[model samples]
Structures are given as C-alpha cells and as structure tokens.
Target: MTTDAIASSFAQYVTESPTAFHAAAVARDQLVAAGFTELSELDAWPTEAGAYVVVRDGAVIAWRLPESATATTPFRILGAHTDSPGFRIKPNPGVRTGGWEQLNVEVYGGALLSTWFDRDLRIAGRVVDADGAVRLVSTDAVARIPNLAIHLDRGVNDGKEIDRQRHTLPVVGIDAAFGGTDVLDWLRGRVGEAVSWDLFLADTQAPARIGIDGAFLASGRMDNLTSVHAGLRGIIEAPADGDHVPVFAAFDHEEIGSSTPSGAGGPFLEDVLGRVQEGLGATRSEAARAFRASWLLSSDAGHLVHPNQPEKHDPTNRPRPGAGPLLKISANQRYMTEAKGEAVWAAACDAAGVTWQPFVNVNTIPGGSTIGPIAATRLGIPTIDIGVGLLSMHSVRELVHVDDLAALHGAVAAFLAG
Candidate 1:
C-alpha cells in the first residue's frame, strides 16, 4: 500500500482503539476478516497449515503456519504492547466537592500530565455484567481536567509541580438537584448493571496528519500502537510459503512493567507456543530446540532528537523522524539488541529495501526500556529492539513522521517472512 493509504488506515485504527481491550478486539476482528480463524484456549488447535488467532483478555496472538512447517520449525515473532500511559478510573469513582462532581482516577504510568489539562476526555474499557458477560464500553466526551486560570497562578508559566492526587481529578458533572449523581450509575445505564470494570480515561480527539505538506502524524497512544499496527499489517501481507511460522503478539500492561497475566513478563507467549508445538506432535526436547532457534523482533517506539533539547540525545548517533525506523541499543541490557540480533535486523531491512538508523541515549540521561529485555528473559529467545522514531512519546498526543510509519510496516513484514 502507498504511504498515504497506510497512514490513513493507521489513523482509523488509533481512533477506534481507546483502551487495551478495544485494541485487542479490533485486531481480532481485522484478523478474522482476513480469513484467520479465532481459537479458544480450552479447545484443541489444528496442526494443519493455516492462519489462526487467539485473544486472552487484553492480549492477542496470531500466527500463520507454512505447509513445510514441522514440530521443530522455528518461529519469527513480532512483539508489541497494547496499553499506553494514562489515568485509570478508581472504584467508587464519583467525587463531589463544593457542588462539583468529578471522577477519581489513579495515575497508571509515566504520563505527561500537563498535556491532559483542558482536553476532551472519555472513559473506555471492559465491563463485566451480573450475568458473567464481558462487554467493551466507550463513552463520548463527558469529562475534562481544566487547568487553573493564569490570573490565579501567575507563576504557572514556570516549572510548576503537579500533585497527582489533588490536581489531576477530572470534572465530570455537577449536582442538578438535592440528589447527587454517581458515575457508576451512568455506566450501568449504558452497559446494564456492570458489577465490575477496568476503565481508563482517554483523549477523544481523532488522529490526523499535521505539519507542512502533511509530513507528520499526531495521535494519542502512538508510543506502541504504531508498532502494533505495523505488525498486524505485516503478518497479513506476508507470503504464506515462508519456512518458519510468523507470529504477532501484542500484550497489555507494558506501561506498568508487564508483570500481569497478559503482560510480556508473564507466560502467555510461552504457553501458546508450547501448545502450538504440542499440536505439531513435538516432544519436550523438540519444543526446547524450536525455542532455541526462534527469533523475536521486539517493536516499540524510540526517541527522536528533539529540535529544542538536542543535548538530551547522543551526539554521534542521533536519529530523526522521516529518515527511517530506529534500531535501539543499550549497553546495560536495557534493550535486548546485540551483535547477532543487529545483523538479523539489518538483513531484514536490507531485504525489504528500507532505511534505518541507530538510537542510543546520552551518557547523562538514561533511556526507558521496552518489552524486549523482559520477553527475552522470559522465553530465552534472541530478541532485537526496533521501532519508528517519535517526539512527545508519552504525551496525551504524540508525533511521528508519515514516511517512517509506512517504512516500519515493510521492515516488519520482511522480518516475519524470515
């Protein structure tokens, strides 16, 4: 597909995915539409060559098996996360102070809290009803966290510290009569007696192309969603005749250190891979050998050299947007990329005719890590970290080059094709 077409489709995907649950569900629907059969964890899987997908809560894993595949055939996996940094609604979320009703929320991850001020925000996530049914729920713009007036705090132009507990509550409504309103009641009205929920607050703005000649794309949750979309497109467009199995695994809770059941640090990927090997009639030793031969491309967003804060990036190996995707490196094992893994990614990019650059942090400023090291430790598979460059990575709205976004899809497709 053309770069413009890819950008357009990605914008729609980001708009439709406000929470991790929505992201997983959207990916499942797209895979099913592409002739991939959905599987249940309790049911027996087919060993014959075909396309299959399975979803576990907010995580989804899909794979395509080749006709030449065997019990010991290796896998080429592309990994990413579905969750982003934001605020999650607390239980008994309704709060009233001086006649104003607000929603109590807890900070979920490392968020740029200032950007969330005065934005149109909505609540989105999964809800469990009394009948033991799980339903996805998304609401319109119904709440906002308005910033203090400049006149009231003239020093706000300087570096002002924000209190997560006292300053981050979002106003949702006001008491209309003697009785007060509860946010849970409003949610129950929509989803029918929701007994429990895993809801989060998200920006309601649509993703769009901005900057000169539409050179840039801006959207929320692009930190990892960009990689998720690239992997989805890569697996769908890859040839079915490759020698190895191609797998796409997007897990949740990466923002909070991926320790949950559906996170990369958990056993979700290992369990599925073991079951797949079992379906292929593999012995225990053969399964171990297959894992040893497998490779994982841990795809996540990387930082670009900021025009204003150039000193924060490595001077010699500075990466920029629109040039290409990034191959992240860290000497402290923060990233899983090594000499052998670098060669594997270089070959993939060369085979796809795509350009890429190296990304490293400055000596003074340490960079954040991705799911690469965690997954590598868990599965003991050779892994490499790679992604598109972006600015404002953890903000409510993030920015990325349109060309880099499309090139990432090509590189991931090449990697998945082995």
Candidate 2:
C-alpha cells in the first residue's frame, strides 16, 4: 500500500479498536487474511516453516518462519501494547443523584481527567453471561461528563483537582424515577445475554487528519496503537523468507504495569517463544542460546518537547513531531535501550533511509515506562525502545505527525527484514 493508504488504514484501525479485545480480534482477522494459521496453545505446534498466530485473551503473537530456520536461528521480535488510558465501568456502577442517572467509573490508567469532561462517550468491552458465553459489546454515544460551570467554581481558572469518584462520574440520563432501565439493563440488551461485564468508556469521536496541511493526525488511543499498527504493518510488508524468525507481539495491560496473564510482564511471550523454538526443532539448551541471540524492539509512544513547555524535556535531547521516531532512553532503565540496542535501531534507520531522533526526560522529571523494560527483564533479551513523538499523551485524544508514522513503519520493516 502507498504511504497515504497506510495512514488512512491506520486511522480506521484506531476507530474500530475501542477495547483491547476488539483490537486483538481485528489483528487476528488481518493475519488470517494474510494466510497465517491460528494455532492453539493447548495443541501441539507445527514444526514446518510458515506463518502462524497465537492469541490469548487480549494479546496476540504472530510470526513467519523460513524453511531453513532451525533451533539456533535468532528471532526479530517487535512488541507493543493494545490497551490505552480511559475510564472503566465498575461492577455496580449505577447512581442517581439530583434526578440524574450517572455511572460510577474509575480511571483505568493515568488518564487526563479534565479532557474527558464535556465529551460524548460510548461503552465497549467484553461481557460475560450467566451461561459463561463471552460477547463483545459496543454502543452508541450514551453518556456525557459535562464540566461544572465557571460561575460555580470560579477557581477553575486556577488549578482544579478532580476527585475520581465525584468529578469523573458520567451522566447517562436525567430521570427522577430511574427504576426500570438502568445502565446494566441497557448493557444487557446490547450484550443479549450478559449477566456482568467489564466495560470501558471510550470517546465517540472518530480519527481525522488535522492541521492546516493535514500533516497532523488526531485520534484516541494513539499513545500505543500507533506502535501496534506500525508493528503489524512491518510484519506484513516483510519478506516471508529471512535468516531470522520475524515475530510481532501486541500485548495487553501495559498501561497498568503489565502484570496480567496477557501482559508483557507475564509468561505469555516466553511461553510462545519457547513453543516456537520447540516447533522449529530446538532442544532446551539450543532454545536458550537462540533467546540469548534474539533481540526485541519494544515500540511505544514517546513525548515530544511541548511547544509551550520546552523546559519539560531534556535540553540536549528534544524530540519533535514529523522529524522521525525517537530512540527512548532513561538513566533509571525505564526504557530498555542500551548501547547495543541503540546500534540496532540506528542501523535499521540507516538502511530504511529514515531520520531518527533521541528522547530523554528532564533531569527533575521522570517519564512513564512501557513494555520494553518489563519484557526485557522478563526474557533477559537485548531490547531497544522506539516510538513516534506524541503530544498531549494520556489525554482523551492524542496527536502525531503523519510523516513520523510512516518513518516508524519503514524503520520497523527494515529491522524485521534485516
């Protein structure tokens, strides 16, 4: 596909992926259409050379194997997360105050609570029924978190603190007698037969190409979905036959420290890699050797120096949108990028003819971590952190340059191909 087509495809993918479960499902469809066989973790894996995908609840691992590949062959792995920061619906979330029906919710990650105010919101997530059947549910815009009037809180001009339980509640409807059809009742209708569900509030706005020249793309979930899309595109564009086994892993639960079964900090990737080695006819010792030789490119979003707040970023390492992807580094090892990892990314960029930049947080300000450090520690692999520079991260919506996204895609494809 052309570069313009790639950007448009990515926007559509972001719009369709409201939850991690939905994102994984969309990726699975794409892999299957590309002739990848879906394998079961319970069943024995195939020992032949081909394309295959393995899926857990919300995580997916896809790879391509060459016929000549063996136990000792090194693997090229690209990693990203599927989940983003938002509001999650509680189990018993119904509340009626002052003749208005509201839904109680908690912050999922480090969300910008203020941006969520005065925005139309929808619901989407996995719902489980009494019969133990799981169903994915999405609804039209049904809630709004209207901000308080300036007259009511005149201190709004100053810094205003948001109380999670009080200020973040979204009003669904205004009803004095909210007896019959509450939030759960409405959810049941959409879920068909669901008894309970883990629902998340999502922005109803669609992704769009913004800016005067349309150089900027604005959308929700760009914090990490951009990396996820880039990784998948790289794998698809890569040659089927290569010296190393090319793997793409889109894990879930990174925003929350990645401690779950499908998270990067868990055993999911390790198990899948072990199975791949065994399927490729490797012994335990050879598998260990292969892992030592393998490398991981942990892709996520990095913060660019804000135009108005330049002091927030490191003076020497200022990343800007539209330049290129950044090699994220941290003195505290928040990112897994080391000297070897930096060389790996630099070579990839040079081969792809893409300009790359460096990113480091300010001395006094510590930045958030991604799946890079977590996965690197868990697998003991040489890993580098790379991402497109973003603005207004963890907000209801985020921004990125179209050129940066293209650069990221090119760099990742080159890395996987090499």
Candidate 3:
C-alpha cells in the first residue's frame, strides 16, 4: 500500500472500530477488496498462496501457505487482539437521578480513569439484527460520555476511587424524559437505520502526530487496535510466494482472559490451523508437526517510560517511544519470548536494520497480560511478542509516537516479507 493509502486506512480503522467485531469486519473488507480469498470457519480454506480467512466476529486469521507442504511444515503467524477496554451497554442500563438520567455501563477491561475525564466520548460497535446479520455502527458525530464537574468531586484529586458499576457509568443525558428507549431510538436513527445489536461506548478520537517534531501519536484504543491495523495490512501486503503462508489473527476478550471462541485461549487458532492442514490433505499428526514448526508473533502494546514517573521504570530497560518496536519481557511470563524466540526476533530486526529495545517493569509493579503465552501453548510453536511502547495504556487517550506508527508498519511488513 502507498503512504497515502496507509494513512487513509489507519484513519478509517481508528474511527470505525470501537469494538472487536467492527474491527474484524473493517479489516476483512480491506483484504477482500485487495483480491485476497476469504475463508470461513464453516468451510475449509484451500491451502494455497494468497488465501485469507476471518474467524468469528472479533477475530480474523488469514494465511497464504505452500500447496505441497504437509502439516509438519512450520507456519508463520501474527496475532493481535481487536478488542479494547471500554463501557458495554448492559441489558437494563438506564438510571434517573438529580434530573439527569444516564446509560449505565460495565467496564470491559482495565482503563485509566483519569485520562477519560473531560474528553469527548462516543458509542460504537457491532449490532446483530433479527435476521442474524451483523452491521457495524458508530456515534463519531456526537458525545455520549461526559465527565462530572471538578467541584462536585473534590476528592477526585485526593485519589477518588471510581466504581466501575456506579460513578463511572457514563451520563448519557441530562433529562429523564430522554432516557432509555429514547436513547436507543436516537442511536438507531443516528445511523440512519434501525438495529438491535451489541453496542459499546467509546471515545471517537483520531490518532495523529503530535509535538513540534512530530514525535507522538495521541489516540484512543491504540493498545490492540493499532496492532490489529498493522497485522491486517501486513497480511494484505505480504507477497504471495508459494508455500509461505501469511496468517493473521485478531482475537477478542484479551483484556480479560481468552476462554471464549473468539479469544486466544479457545478454538480460533487451533481450529484454523487444523483446517489448513486437512484442506491440504495432510494427516492430523502432520498438522501437529506443521504447527510445532510454526512461529506466532503475538502483537500487543508495551508500556513506555512515563515522564512523570521516571523512578518507576528500570534504569536501563526503559523503552522509549519512537525508537522502534519494544521487546517485552516479564519474569512471570506476561510475555512469551524464550531465548530462541528473542534471538529470532533480534535477527529479524538486524536484517531489517530497525532499532529495538527491551521493555520490563520496575520490580514492584507487575505488568499486565497479553495473548503471547496462550498462542505459544496452543500452537506449541515458539512465540515472540512485540509492540509499540505506549503511555497511558488503557486510557481513553493513549500516547505513542507518530513515527512509531510508520515504524511499526515497516517492521511488520519486513517481518511478513521475510
């Protein structure tokens, strides 16, 4: 893809995807338009070059494999999550108090409470209709979640604890008469259509270059969504050389744990790999061998050094924004890079002439989890996870380097091309 095209595509992804399903749909559209073959879970995909398939609504795993290879041949896989931590619409989610009724929401994952304050919030997600057809929708043109006044919550500065079930439920309206059903009707009309589907409240912010030197990117849901875009593009752009399968997986439920069908811990990856082998007329044992020789790059976000909390990061391992991709390591296996895996990644970076750094948290505060270990265990393949280092992770507005955006594209493209 050209630079102009990449920018436009990234803009569309940043604006359209507020949930995992929508992200997968958007990516599938792009890949499909590029003449890539689409596969489905209901049917087996032919094991050949240039074939791509999406699984579930929240995840997509596409590949271009060698036609003659048995299941014992190793596969190259890139994994990224499509979901973001935000407020989900509850079944009964309306409340009226103090002449202001709001849409009560459940927090999906870990979110930085303070970053959400005083920012424009919107609702966007996939809505399944009665006919079982899923349509993607968005509220980018309006504000749905607004912060409470500082005067009302003086303790906010003294470390106010935000109850995900209560205080954090976004105030959707200032009038009781305009609550509940009215809000749903308004949402249905906003899309210029009527639909009943899963909806998630989110921030409708665009990711862009910031700072005088174009050093930063301020955006919403950059954690996994950024990786989602990169992986999709990588798969689409990778050359269709025979026998070198290019696979992509956009998983859901990563913010929590991966037990669902769309999660990393479930049948998504395994089922797809098995199908690929079977479609190629290989035996089950051959499929196991092919998977064992494979490599899965679990793409997720890493924490960058915070300017305000310099003391909280390790002195040498602090990952800087705009440097390059971050090689995340945790003693507890929050990341899944083994010694051989690291060597493979290091060699990849060296071949591409791209700079890289190690990321580790200060000993006191443990890091969060990614889909790394799950992919490794399921495939029994060596795995290495890398991502753009970020600040204000899980925040409504996360910070990254704009250069890092292009850097990620280049790195991922190089990885796929190899």
Per-model lDDT? 0.92, 0.89, 0.75
Backbone clash count, each prediction separately: 0, 0, 6
Q: Deviation in angstroms for 294 in model 1? A: 1.3
Provide the global lDDT of candidate 2 against the true structure: 0.89
Highest TM-score model number: 1
Better of 2 and 3 by lDDT: 2
Return the candidate ranking by TM-score, descending: 1, 2, 3
Cα error of candidate 1 at position 253, Å: 0.4
| Global fold similarity of model 3 (TM-score) | 0.92
* Runs off by more than 4 Å, candidate 1: 176-180
Residues 1-418, candidate 1: write the lDDT tens digits: 8999999999999999999999999999999999999999899889888999999999999999888888899999999999999999998888777777889999988999999999999999999988888999999998899899999999999979999998999998885344666766776787677889999999999998999799999999998999999999988887788878899999999999999999999999999898888888899889888888999999999999999999999989989888889999999989989999999999999988889999988989888999999999999889999999999999999999999998898899999988
Model 2, 140-208: lDDT tens digits are 899999899999999998999889888899999865374545766666677787777878999999988
Q: Give the range of the ten consecutive residues with the poorest summed lDDT in model 1.
A: 175-184
In angstroms, the error of model 3 at 54 is: 1.9
Where does candidate 3 clash, by residue pair? 64-245, 64-246, 66-243, 71-290, 72-290, 127-197
**Model 3 misses residue 301 by how many Å?**
0.6
* Ranked candidates, highest lDDT first: 1, 2, 3
